[model samples]
Target: AQSVAQPEDQVNVAEGNPLTVKCTYSVSGNPYLFWYVQYPNRGLQFLLKYITGDNLVKGSYGFEAEFNKSQTSFHLKKPSALVSDSALYFCAVGGFKTIFGAGTRLFVKA
Candidate 1:
């Protein structure tokens, strides 16, 4: 069974502070990991991906993710949160078909 779990339904961060949205997964072979952000009534924007290589990967909007194979986790992070960064975030795994977690709504207060 392959699946991704975003434990948090929502994450609240004060502007300028670092933020993190947790994610964990289960897969048979090496997984194609991805992070995407979605705004109200908009399509998801690709943030980053972990195919195979370095554990730490950086992506758009100053976002990054650390892939922990032992823990089966790939957590999203940012140094400073922005109000504009407040949006829905999703953790996904790619294989025969892409599977997405429920999603985490991030709120960056101004």
Candidate 2:
């Protein structure tokens, strides 16, 4: 079985400050990790992914994730968070079967 966990229900950050949305995974085989964001009444948007190669992977909207095999984690990070970045974030892990975390709502305050 493959599973991902977003321990925090919500992550609050200042508009100009850095932000992190933590994610941990457990899978049987080589796993694929992905991050997606959903805004109000909108569909999920791809953020970043970690499959292989570089441990540090960068993606859309100034986001990046570090793939740590030792820790079994791929936490999303942004150097500076914007109010517009506030949304629901999902962490997914998959080998053959894909599983999504409960989701973490990010709020960036001005």
Candidate 3:
């Protein structure tokens, strides 16, 4: 069975500071990790993915993530944060059904 865990329900950050949303996963075989964001009354949008290659993967909206196999962790990171970046973030691991974490709400304040 594949599963994902997002320990925090919400993360708060200042508008200009760096932000991070943590994610951990467990899978039987080689796994595919992905990050998605959802805005109010909107569908989930793909942020980034770790298929195979470099450990550091960059994605839309100046977002990036590090894939750590030994730790089984895929933590999302942003160089600089923006108020517009505040949203519901989900960490997912692809396998059978593509299990998703409960979601972490990010609050960016100016």
Candidate 4:
């Protein structure tokens, strides 16, 4: 079965500091990894994706993720956090069907 797990329920970081949200996955075949962000009551906005290219993939809002096949992980990172960046982030995996993690709420304190 294909699945994704976000180990953190919430990640709190002060504005201007680097931040990271952990993600791990399980799949039967080749996997497509994606990161999305959502604000209150809003649909997820595509951040980035890793199909089959370089290990490090960059996306919108200065966010980037590294795909590790051996570890089955794709952790999202940013150099500096912003209060506006505070929102719910989701890591997803697509194979036969798409699956999303429970999601991690990021609170960037000002």
lDDT of 2 by residue, 5-108 (tens): 99999999999999999999998778899999999999999888888899999999999999999999999999999999999999999745668999999999
Quote the lDDT for 2 in model 1: 84
Q: Model 2, which residues run further than 4 Å from truth?
A: none
Q: Write the per-residue lDDT of candidate 4 for residues 1-110, one digit (tens) a residue.
A: 88999999999999999999999999877789999999999999999999998999999999999999999999999999999999999999994467999999999999
Q: Which ten residues in a row have the lowest lDDT in candidate 1?
A: 90-99
RMSD of each: 0.7, 1.0, 0.9, 1.0
Candidate number with greatest lDDT: 1
TM-score of each: 0.98, 0.96, 0.97, 0.96
Say which candidate scores most in TM-score.
1
Q: Assess candidate 4 and give its lDDT.
A: 0.95
Residue pairs in clash, model 1:
none
- Write candidate 1's Cα lDDT for 2-107 as tens digits: 8999999999999999999999999999999999999999999999999999999999999999999999999999999999999999999985689999999999
Q: How many clashes does the backbone of model 3 have?
A: 0
* lDDT, candidates in the order shown: 0.97, 0.93, 0.95, 0.95
